[model samples]
Target: MGNWDHLVGASWRGECWAGARAELPLLLGVLPFGLVYGVLGLQAGLPGWAVVLMSSIVFGGSSQVVFAQLWGAGVPAPVIVGTVGVVNLRHALYSASVAQLLAELPLRWKLLLAYLLTDEAYMAAVGRLTSGPRSAVRHWFLFGTGFTLWAGWQLSTLGGVLLGATIPAGWALDFSIALTFIALLVPSLRRRSECVAAAVAGAVALLAQGVPYKLWILLAALAGMLAGMLAQALQRGKSHE
Candidate 1:
Protein backbone atom coordinates (compact mmCIF):
# COMPACT_ATOMS: atom_id res chain seq x y z
CA MET A 1 0.00 0.00 0.00
CA GLY A 2 2.86 2.40 0.75
CA ASN A 3 4.45 1.75 -2.64
CA TRP A 4 1.09 2.22 -4.40
CA ASP A 5 0.51 5.54 -2.63
CA HIS A 6 3.96 6.77 -3.62
CA LEU A 7 3.34 5.84 -7.25
CA VAL A 8 0.00 7.67 -7.31
CA GLY A 9 1.50 10.83 -5.89
CA ALA A 10 4.34 10.73 -8.39
CA SER A 11 1.90 10.31 -11.29
CA TRP A 12 -0.22 13.23 -10.12
CA ARG A 13 2.81 15.45 -9.83
CA GLY A 14 3.93 14.54 -13.32
CA GLU A 15 0.51 15.36 -14.76
CA CYS A 16 0.49 18.75 -13.13
CA TRP A 17 3.97 19.50 -14.45
CA ALA A 18 2.94 18.53 -17.97
CA GLY A 19 -0.05 20.83 -17.82
CA ALA A 20 2.05 23.67 -16.48
CA ARG A 21 4.60 23.16 -19.25
CA ALA A 22 1.88 23.27 -21.89
CA GLU A 23 0.66 26.58 -20.52
CA LEU A 24 4.06 28.24 -20.13
CA PRO A 25 4.19 29.88 -23.56
CA LEU A 26 0.91 31.69 -22.99
CA LEU A 27 2.09 32.86 -19.58
CA LEU A 28 5.23 34.24 -21.21
CA GLY A 29 3.18 36.14 -23.74
CA VAL A 30 0.79 37.38 -21.07
CA LEU A 31 3.47 38.85 -18.75
CA PRO A 32 3.96 42.01 -20.79
CA PHE A 33 0.23 42.50 -21.14
CA GLY A 34 -0.27 42.28 -17.41
CA LEU A 35 2.51 44.79 -16.86
CA VAL A 36 0.96 47.09 -19.43
CA TYR A 37 -2.42 46.76 -17.76
CA GLY A 38 -0.93 47.74 -14.40
CA VAL A 39 0.88 50.75 -15.79
CA LEU A 40 -2.13 51.85 -17.77
CA GLY A 41 -4.45 51.36 -14.83
CA LEU A 42 -2.25 53.61 -12.73
CA GLN A 43 -1.89 56.16 -15.56
CA ALA A 44 -5.65 56.14 -15.94
CA GLY A 45 -5.97 57.17 -12.27
CA LEU A 46 -7.09 53.91 -10.69
CA PRO A 47 -5.88 53.34 -7.14
CA GLY A 48 -3.02 50.90 -6.53
CA TRP A 49 -5.09 48.67 -4.30
CA ALA A 50 -7.85 48.67 -6.91
CA VAL A 51 -5.32 47.53 -9.50
CA VAL A 52 -4.22 44.57 -7.40
CA LEU A 53 -7.75 43.62 -6.43
CA MET A 54 -8.91 43.83 -10.03
CA SER A 55 -6.14 41.48 -11.09
CA SER A 56 -7.12 39.00 -8.36
CA ILE A 57 -10.89 39.31 -8.59
CA VAL A 58 -11.62 40.27 -12.17
CA PHE A 59 -8.59 38.48 -13.64
CA GLY A 60 -9.60 39.66 -17.10
CA GLY A 61 -7.08 42.01 -18.67
CA SER A 62 -9.20 43.50 -21.47
CA SER A 63 -12.15 44.02 -19.16
CA GLN A 64 -9.92 45.51 -16.50
CA VAL A 65 -8.51 47.96 -19.01
CA VAL A 66 -11.99 48.94 -20.12
CA PHE A 67 -13.10 49.39 -16.54
CA ALA A 68 -10.13 51.59 -15.69
CA GLN A 69 -10.62 53.73 -18.78
CA LEU A 70 -14.30 54.17 -18.04
CA TRP A 71 -13.66 54.99 -14.41
CA GLY A 72 -11.05 57.56 -15.32
CA ALA A 73 -13.29 59.16 -17.91
CA GLY A 74 -16.21 59.29 -15.46
CA VAL A 75 -18.47 57.12 -17.54
CA PRO A 76 -21.69 55.97 -15.92
CA ALA A 77 -21.46 52.77 -13.94
CA PRO A 78 -24.07 50.99 -16.07
CA VAL A 79 -22.22 51.78 -19.26
CA ILE A 80 -18.99 50.51 -17.78
CA VAL A 81 -20.54 47.29 -16.66
CA GLY A 82 -22.30 46.82 -19.97
CA THR A 83 -19.13 47.45 -21.92
CA VAL A 84 -17.04 45.05 -19.84
CA GLY A 85 -19.79 42.48 -19.97
CA VAL A 86 -19.82 42.65 -23.78
CA VAL A 87 -16.06 42.26 -24.06
CA ASN A 88 -16.28 39.17 -21.87
CA LEU A 89 -19.05 37.63 -23.94
CA ARG A 90 -16.56 35.29 -25.58
CA HIS A 91 -16.31 33.45 -22.30
CA ALA A 92 -19.67 31.90 -23.05
CA LEU A 93 -18.42 30.09 -26.14
CA TYR A 94 -15.34 28.94 -24.27
CA SER A 95 -17.39 27.69 -21.38
CA ALA A 96 -19.60 25.68 -23.71
CA SER A 97 -16.70 24.13 -25.60
CA VAL A 98 -14.79 23.17 -22.46
CA ALA A 99 -17.92 22.09 -20.67
CA GLN A 100 -18.56 19.24 -23.09
CA LEU A 101 -15.11 17.86 -22.33
CA LEU A 102 -15.44 18.37 -18.60
CA ALA A 103 -18.94 16.98 -18.21
CA GLU A 104 -17.72 14.24 -15.89
CA LEU A 105 -15.96 16.67 -13.58
CA PRO A 106 -17.39 17.84 -10.28
CA LEU A 107 -19.51 21.00 -10.13
CA ARG A 108 -16.82 22.84 -8.19
CA TRP A 109 -14.12 22.00 -10.71
CA LYS A 110 -16.30 23.16 -13.55
CA LEU A 111 -17.13 26.41 -11.76
CA LEU A 112 -13.48 27.09 -10.91
CA LEU A 113 -12.31 26.45 -14.46
CA ALA A 114 -15.13 28.54 -15.88
CA TYR A 115 -13.86 31.45 -13.84
CA LEU A 116 -10.25 30.96 -14.94
CA LEU A 117 -10.99 30.28 -18.60
CA THR A 118 -9.20 32.97 -20.54
CA ASP A 119 -8.92 33.04 -24.34
CA GLU A 120 -5.30 31.91 -24.40
CA ALA A 121 -5.76 28.95 -22.06
CA TYR A 122 -8.95 27.83 -23.82
CA MET A 123 -7.28 27.95 -27.24
CA ALA A 124 -4.25 26.03 -26.01
CA ALA A 125 -6.26 23.28 -24.30
CA VAL A 126 -8.66 22.92 -27.22
CA GLY A 127 -5.72 22.40 -29.57
CA ARG A 128 -4.26 19.79 -27.23
CA LEU A 129 -7.51 17.89 -26.89
CA THR A 130 -8.27 17.99 -30.60
CA SER A 131 -4.82 16.62 -31.42
CA GLY A 132 -5.20 13.50 -29.27
CA PRO A 133 -7.50 10.90 -27.82
CA ARG A 134 -9.65 12.11 -24.94
CA SER A 135 -8.51 11.68 -21.38
CA ALA A 136 -10.08 12.51 -18.04
CA VAL A 137 -6.84 14.02 -16.85
CA ARG A 138 -6.82 16.79 -19.50
CA HIS A 139 -9.00 19.01 -17.34
CA TRP A 140 -6.65 18.70 -14.42
CA PHE A 141 -3.75 19.38 -16.72
CA LEU A 142 -5.48 22.47 -18.10
CA PHE A 143 -6.30 23.66 -14.58
CA GLY A 144 -2.62 23.44 -13.63
CA THR A 145 -1.49 25.29 -16.72
CA GLY A 146 -4.22 27.95 -16.55
CA PHE A 147 -3.57 28.53 -12.87
CA THR A 148 0.12 29.15 -13.56
CA LEU A 149 -0.72 31.76 -16.18
CA TRP A 150 -3.22 33.38 -13.82
CA ALA A 151 -0.66 33.68 -11.03
CA GLY A 152 1.96 35.05 -13.41
CA TRP A 153 -0.50 37.71 -14.60
CA GLN A 154 -1.30 38.80 -11.05
CA LEU A 155 2.36 38.95 -9.99
CA SER A 156 3.41 40.82 -13.12
CA THR A 157 0.59 43.31 -12.67
CA LEU A 158 1.63 43.89 -9.05
CA GLY A 159 5.25 44.45 -10.08
CA GLY A 160 4.19 46.93 -12.71
CA VAL A 161 2.06 48.91 -10.27
CA LEU A 162 5.02 49.10 -7.93
CA LEU A 163 7.69 49.97 -10.51
CA GLY A 164 5.62 51.79 -13.12
CA ALA A 165 6.94 55.22 -12.27
CA THR A 166 10.53 54.09 -12.60
CA ILE A 167 10.13 52.79 -16.11
CA PRO A 168 11.04 55.36 -18.80
CA ALA A 169 8.21 56.67 -20.94
CA GLY A 170 10.24 56.09 -24.14
CA TRP A 171 10.62 52.38 -23.39
CA ALA A 172 7.05 51.68 -24.58
CA LEU A 173 6.52 48.33 -22.88
CA ASP A 174 2.86 48.85 -23.77
CA PHE A 175 3.73 48.54 -27.45
CA SER A 176 5.48 45.28 -26.65
CA ILE A 177 2.22 44.11 -25.13
CA ALA A 178 0.40 44.98 -28.34
CA LEU A 179 3.01 43.09 -30.33
CA THR A 180 2.52 40.13 -28.02
CA PHE A 181 -1.20 40.22 -28.69
CA ILE A 182 -0.52 40.23 -32.42
CA ALA A 183 1.75 37.25 -32.06
CA LEU A 184 -0.88 35.41 -30.05
CA LEU A 185 -3.48 36.31 -32.67
CA VAL A 186 -1.36 35.16 -35.62
CA PRO A 187 -1.72 31.47 -34.88
CA SER A 188 -5.46 31.89 -34.47
CA LEU A 189 -5.72 33.08 -38.05
CA ARG A 190 -6.24 29.52 -39.17
CA ARG A 191 -9.39 29.07 -41.24
CA ARG A 192 -10.83 31.26 -43.97
CA SER A 193 -13.96 31.84 -41.93
CA GLU A 194 -11.94 32.93 -38.94
CA CYS A 195 -9.91 35.26 -41.11
CA VAL A 196 -13.08 36.81 -42.49
CA ALA A 197 -14.46 37.21 -39.02
CA ALA A 198 -11.34 39.04 -37.84
CA ALA A 199 -11.39 41.35 -40.84
CA VAL A 200 -15.03 42.16 -40.23
CA ALA A 201 -14.37 42.89 -36.59
CA GLY A 202 -11.50 45.23 -37.44
CA ALA A 203 -13.64 47.11 -39.90
CA VAL A 204 -16.48 47.47 -37.42
CA ALA A 205 -14.15 48.69 -34.72
CA LEU A 206 -12.64 51.27 -37.03
CA LEU A 207 -16.04 52.52 -38.09
CA ALA A 208 -17.23 52.67 -34.50
CA GLN A 209 -13.99 53.98 -32.98
CA GLY A 210 -15.42 57.42 -32.16
CA VAL A 211 -18.08 55.98 -29.87
CA PRO A 212 -17.92 56.99 -26.22
CA TYR A 213 -15.90 55.24 -23.50
CA LYS A 214 -14.58 52.27 -25.53
CA LEU A 215 -17.91 50.76 -26.36
CA TRP A 216 -16.50 49.87 -29.77
CA ILE A 217 -14.51 46.98 -28.42
CA LEU A 218 -17.69 45.27 -27.34
CA LEU A 219 -19.33 45.99 -30.68
CA ALA A 220 -16.32 44.59 -32.49
CA ALA A 221 -16.45 41.37 -30.50
CA LEU A 222 -20.14 40.94 -31.16
CA ALA A 223 -19.67 41.59 -34.84
CA GLY A 224 -16.84 39.08 -34.97
CA MET A 225 -18.84 36.40 -33.20
CA LEU A 226 -21.80 36.81 -35.49
CA ALA A 227 -19.63 36.78 -38.59
CA GLY A 228 -17.72 33.71 -37.47
CA MET A 229 -20.88 31.79 -36.67
CA LEU A 230 -22.41 32.71 -40.02
CA ALA A 231 -19.29 31.69 -41.89
CA GLN A 232 -19.22 28.36 -40.07
CA ALA A 233 -22.82 27.63 -40.93
CA LEU A 234 -22.22 28.41 -44.59
CA GLN A 235 -19.23 26.09 -44.67
CA ARG A 236 -21.25 23.31 -43.10
CA GLY A 237 -24.00 23.80 -45.63
CA LYS A 238 -21.56 23.62 -48.52
CA SER A 239 -20.13 20.40 -47.14
CA HIS A 240 -23.52 18.73 -47.03
CA GLU A 241 -24.51 19.76 -50.55
Candidate 2:
Protein backbone atom coordinates (compact mmCIF):
# COMPACT_ATOMS: atom_id res chain seq x y z
CA MET A 1 0.00 0.00 0.00
CA GLY A 2 2.83 2.40 0.78
CA ASN A 3 4.45 1.82 -2.61
CA TRP A 4 1.11 2.25 -4.39
CA ASP A 5 0.51 5.58 -2.65
CA HIS A 6 4.04 6.71 -3.49
CA LEU A 7 3.53 5.95 -7.16
CA VAL A 8 0.30 7.90 -7.26
CA GLY A 9 1.97 10.88 -5.65
CA ALA A 10 4.76 10.77 -8.18
CA SER A 11 2.27 10.67 -11.04
CA TRP A 12 0.49 13.71 -9.69
CA ARG A 13 3.73 15.62 -9.44
CA GLY A 14 4.54 14.71 -13.02
CA GLU A 15 1.21 16.08 -14.21
CA CYS A 16 1.76 19.30 -12.32
CA TRP A 17 5.16 19.83 -13.87
CA ALA A 18 3.82 19.00 -17.31
CA GLY A 19 1.09 21.58 -16.90
CA ALA A 20 3.54 24.26 -15.80
CA ARG A 21 5.82 23.49 -18.72
CA ALA A 22 2.91 23.67 -21.15
CA GLU A 23 1.89 27.06 -19.79
CA LEU A 24 5.32 28.63 -20.17
CA PRO A 25 4.74 29.92 -23.69
CA LEU A 26 1.64 31.89 -22.67
CA LEU A 27 3.66 33.46 -19.87
CA LEU A 28 5.74 35.31 -22.42
CA GLY A 29 2.81 37.60 -23.23
CA VAL A 30 1.70 37.83 -19.62
CA LEU A 31 5.19 38.87 -18.46
CA PRO A 32 5.30 41.84 -20.78
CA PHE A 33 1.77 42.89 -19.88
CA GLY A 34 2.58 42.73 -16.19
CA LEU A 35 5.62 44.87 -16.78
CA VAL A 36 3.48 47.37 -18.66
CA TYR A 37 1.04 47.56 -15.77
CA GLY A 38 3.78 48.12 -13.24
CA VAL A 39 5.35 50.89 -15.27
CA LEU A 40 2.02 52.55 -15.97
CA GLY A 41 0.89 52.27 -12.38
CA LEU A 42 4.06 53.95 -11.18
CA GLN A 43 3.82 56.62 -13.86
CA ALA A 44 0.24 57.23 -12.80
CA GLY A 45 1.62 58.14 -9.37
CA LEU A 46 0.75 54.91 -7.61
CA PRO A 47 3.23 53.90 -4.96
CA GLY A 48 5.51 51.04 -5.94
CA TRP A 49 4.29 48.85 -3.12
CA ALA A 50 0.65 49.44 -3.98
CA VAL A 51 1.32 48.57 -7.61
CA VAL A 52 3.00 45.30 -6.64
CA LEU A 53 0.27 44.55 -4.12
CA MET A 54 -2.39 45.10 -6.74
CA SER A 55 -0.74 42.56 -9.06
CA SER A 56 -0.62 40.00 -6.27
CA ILE A 57 -4.19 40.64 -5.16
CA VAL A 58 -6.08 41.20 -8.38
CA PHE A 59 -4.02 39.02 -10.74
CA GLY A 60 -6.19 40.15 -13.64
CA GLY A 61 -4.17 42.07 -16.20
CA SER A 62 -6.79 44.05 -18.10
CA SER A 63 -8.78 44.87 -14.99
CA GLN A 64 -5.63 45.93 -13.18
CA VAL A 65 -4.73 48.19 -16.07
CA VAL A 66 -8.22 49.71 -16.00
CA PHE A 67 -7.99 50.24 -12.26
CA ALA A 68 -4.61 51.94 -12.54
CA GLN A 69 -5.86 54.19 -15.32
CA LEU A 70 -8.99 55.17 -13.44
CA TRP A 71 -7.25 55.63 -10.12
CA GLY A 72 -4.61 57.77 -11.77
CA ALA A 73 -7.29 59.88 -13.43
CA GLY A 74 -8.57 60.66 -9.95
CA VAL A 75 -11.78 58.78 -10.56
CA PRO A 76 -13.81 58.22 -7.43
CA ALA A 77 -13.24 54.97 -5.59
CA PRO A 78 -16.82 53.76 -5.93
CA VAL A 79 -16.80 54.33 -9.67
CA ILE A 80 -13.49 52.56 -10.01
CA VAL A 81 -14.91 49.63 -8.10
CA GLY A 82 -17.93 49.43 -10.36
CA THR A 83 -15.84 49.75 -13.51
CA VAL A 84 -13.43 47.04 -12.41
CA GLY A 85 -16.30 44.79 -11.46
CA VAL A 86 -17.86 45.19 -14.88
CA VAL A 87 -14.59 44.54 -16.64
CA ASN A 88 -14.05 41.33 -14.68
CA LEU A 89 -17.47 39.88 -15.35
CA ARG A 90 -15.93 37.50 -17.87
CA HIS A 91 -14.43 35.56 -14.99
CA ALA A 92 -17.91 34.52 -13.97
CA LEU A 93 -18.32 32.90 -17.36
CA TYR A 94 -15.00 31.18 -16.93
CA SER A 95 -16.01 29.87 -13.53
CA ALA A 96 -19.25 28.52 -14.87
CA SER A 97 -17.54 26.72 -17.71
CA VAL A 98 -15.08 24.96 -15.45
CA ALA A 99 -17.39 24.45 -12.50
CA GLN A 100 -18.55 21.00 -13.57
CA LEU A 101 -15.06 19.66 -14.07
CA LEU A 102 -14.06 20.87 -10.63
CA ALA A 103 -17.29 20.02 -8.84
CA GLU A 104 -15.68 17.17 -6.92
CA LEU A 105 -12.96 19.39 -5.49
CA PRO A 106 -13.05 20.61 -1.89
CA LEU A 107 -14.30 24.12 -1.26
CA ARG A 108 -10.83 25.31 -0.30
CA TRP A 109 -9.37 23.96 -3.50
CA LYS A 110 -12.13 25.54 -5.52
CA LEU A 111 -11.59 28.88 -3.84
CA LEU A 112 -7.86 28.78 -4.51
CA LEU A 113 -8.37 27.87 -8.16
CA ALA A 114 -11.01 30.54 -8.58
CA TYR A 115 -8.67 33.17 -7.28
CA LEU A 116 -5.95 32.07 -9.67
CA LEU A 117 -8.24 31.83 -12.67
CA THR A 118 -6.80 34.41 -15.09
CA ASP A 119 -7.30 34.37 -18.86
CA GLU A 120 -4.03 32.63 -19.66
CA ALA A 121 -4.41 30.13 -16.86
CA TYR A 122 -7.99 29.30 -17.78
CA MET A 123 -7.22 28.84 -21.46
CA ALA A 124 -4.26 26.62 -20.69
CA ALA A 125 -6.16 24.56 -18.13
CA VAL A 126 -9.28 24.10 -20.21
CA GLY A 127 -7.29 22.99 -23.22
CA ARG A 128 -5.47 20.44 -21.13
CA LEU A 129 -8.62 19.13 -19.49
CA THR A 130 -10.52 18.75 -22.72
CA SER A 131 -7.91 17.57 -25.17
CA GLY A 132 -6.21 14.84 -23.18
CA PRO A 133 -7.14 11.90 -21.00
CA ARG A 134 -8.68 13.22 -17.81
CA SER A 135 -6.45 12.53 -14.86
CA ALA A 136 -7.78 12.06 -11.38
CA VAL A 137 -5.31 14.65 -10.14
CA ARG A 138 -5.80 17.15 -12.94
CA HIS A 139 -6.54 19.96 -10.55
CA TRP A 140 -2.96 19.79 -9.45
CA PHE A 141 -2.05 20.49 -13.02
CA LEU A 142 -4.10 23.67 -12.77
CA PHE A 143 -2.42 24.52 -9.50
CA GLY A 144 0.99 24.20 -11.09
CA THR A 145 0.06 26.44 -13.99
CA GLY A 146 -1.60 29.03 -11.76
CA PHE A 147 1.25 29.08 -9.29
CA THR A 148 3.84 29.45 -12.01
CA LEU A 149 1.87 32.32 -13.52
CA TRP A 150 1.39 33.93 -10.12
CA ALA A 151 5.11 33.87 -9.51
CA GLY A 152 5.86 35.17 -12.98
CA TRP A 153 3.43 38.04 -12.61
CA GLN A 154 4.83 39.09 -9.24
CA LEU A 155 8.40 39.01 -10.51
CA SER A 156 7.56 40.86 -13.73
CA THR A 157 5.61 43.50 -11.83
CA LEU A 158 8.52 44.00 -9.47
CA GLY A 159 10.95 44.33 -12.38
CA GLY A 160 8.70 46.90 -14.08
CA VAL A 161 8.30 48.91 -10.90
CA LEU A 162 12.03 49.03 -10.37
CA LEU A 163 12.70 49.94 -13.99
CA GLY A 164 9.85 52.42 -14.14
CA ALA A 165 11.29 54.43 -11.26
CA THR A 166 14.39 55.21 -13.30
CA ILE A 167 12.60 55.99 -16.58
CA PRO A 168 11.41 59.51 -17.36
CA ALA A 169 7.67 60.17 -17.45
CA GLY A 170 8.01 62.09 -20.74
CA TRP A 171 8.55 58.77 -22.54
CA ALA A 172 4.79 58.01 -22.14
CA LEU A 173 5.01 54.27 -21.44
CA ASP A 174 1.42 54.35 -20.30
CA PHE A 175 0.10 54.24 -23.85
CA SER A 176 1.63 50.80 -24.19
CA ILE A 177 -1.16 49.53 -21.97
CA ALA A 178 -3.68 50.19 -24.73
CA LEU A 179 -1.39 48.52 -27.25
CA THR A 180 -1.06 45.51 -24.98
CA PHE A 181 -4.84 45.22 -24.80
CA ILE A 182 -5.09 45.48 -28.56
CA ALA A 183 -2.52 42.74 -28.97
CA LEU A 184 -4.53 40.51 -26.67
CA LEU A 185 -7.85 41.38 -28.26
CA VAL A 186 -6.91 41.04 -31.91
CA PRO A 187 -5.98 37.37 -31.71
CA SER A 188 -9.36 36.41 -30.23
CA LEU A 189 -11.25 37.83 -33.21
CA ARG A 190 -11.09 34.76 -35.42
CA ARG A 191 -14.79 33.96 -35.65
CA ARG A 192 -17.19 36.14 -37.61
CA SER A 193 -19.27 36.84 -34.53
CA GLU A 194 -16.18 37.76 -32.60
CA CYS A 195 -15.05 40.12 -35.34
CA VAL A 196 -18.48 41.76 -35.51
CA ALA A 197 -18.60 42.10 -31.78
CA ALA A 198 -15.17 43.73 -31.65
CA ALA A 199 -16.02 46.11 -34.48
CA VAL A 200 -19.28 47.18 -32.84
CA ALA A 201 -17.65 47.62 -29.48
CA GLY A 202 -14.83 49.69 -30.93
CA ALA A 203 -17.32 51.95 -32.66
CA VAL A 204 -19.39 52.35 -29.52
CA ALA A 205 -16.31 53.15 -27.48
CA LEU A 206 -15.28 55.85 -29.88
CA LEU A 207 -18.78 57.32 -30.01
CA ALA A 208 -19.18 57.31 -26.24
CA GLN A 209 -15.66 58.44 -25.46
CA GLY A 210 -17.01 61.51 -23.67
CA VAL A 211 -19.12 59.54 -21.19
CA PRO A 212 -18.26 60.39 -17.61
CA TYR A 213 -16.68 57.94 -15.18
CA LYS A 214 -15.43 55.74 -18.03
CA LEU A 215 -18.92 54.31 -18.40
CA TRP A 216 -18.25 53.99 -22.09
CA ILE A 217 -16.09 50.94 -21.48
CA LEU A 218 -18.88 49.09 -19.70
CA LEU A 219 -21.38 50.06 -22.37
CA ALA A 220 -19.02 48.97 -25.11
CA ALA A 221 -18.38 45.60 -23.45
CA LEU A 222 -22.09 44.95 -23.10
CA ALA A 223 -22.70 45.94 -26.69
CA GLY A 224 -19.95 43.63 -27.85
CA MET A 225 -21.29 40.69 -25.88
CA LEU A 226 -24.78 41.22 -27.19
CA ALA A 227 -23.64 41.61 -30.75
CA GLY A 228 -21.58 38.46 -30.52
CA MET A 229 -24.45 36.50 -28.99
CA LEU A 230 -26.88 37.69 -31.66
CA ALA A 231 -24.51 36.89 -34.44
CA GLN A 232 -23.88 33.41 -33.04
CA ALA A 233 -27.59 32.79 -32.73
CA LEU A 234 -28.18 33.83 -36.33
CA GLN A 235 -25.41 31.57 -37.49
CA ARG A 236 -26.97 28.68 -35.60
CA GLY A 237 -30.37 29.44 -37.09
CA LYS A 238 -28.99 29.45 -40.60
CA SER A 239 -27.23 26.20 -39.94
CA HIS A 240 -30.48 24.64 -38.76
CA GLU A 241 -32.22 25.82 -41.91
Off by over 4 Å in 1: 1-10, 127-136, 167-178
Task: Write model 2 residue lDDT over 57-152, tens digit each, in one string.
Answer: 898888888888888778889888888887898899889988998899999999999998878887777766555556688787788788889999
| Cα TM-score of candidate 1 | 0.85
Candidate 1 local lDDT, 164-209, one digit each (tens): 7776644544456557656777787989789878888889978997
TM-score of each: 0.85, 0.91
Q: How does residue 91 of candidate 1 score in lDDT?
A: 83
Candidate 1 root-mean-square deviation in Å: 5.0
Question: Residue-pair clashes per candidate, as listed?
Answer: 0, 0
Query: Candidate 2: where is the Cα deviation over 4 Å?
Result: 1-10
Give me the candidate number with maximum lDDT.
Answer: 2
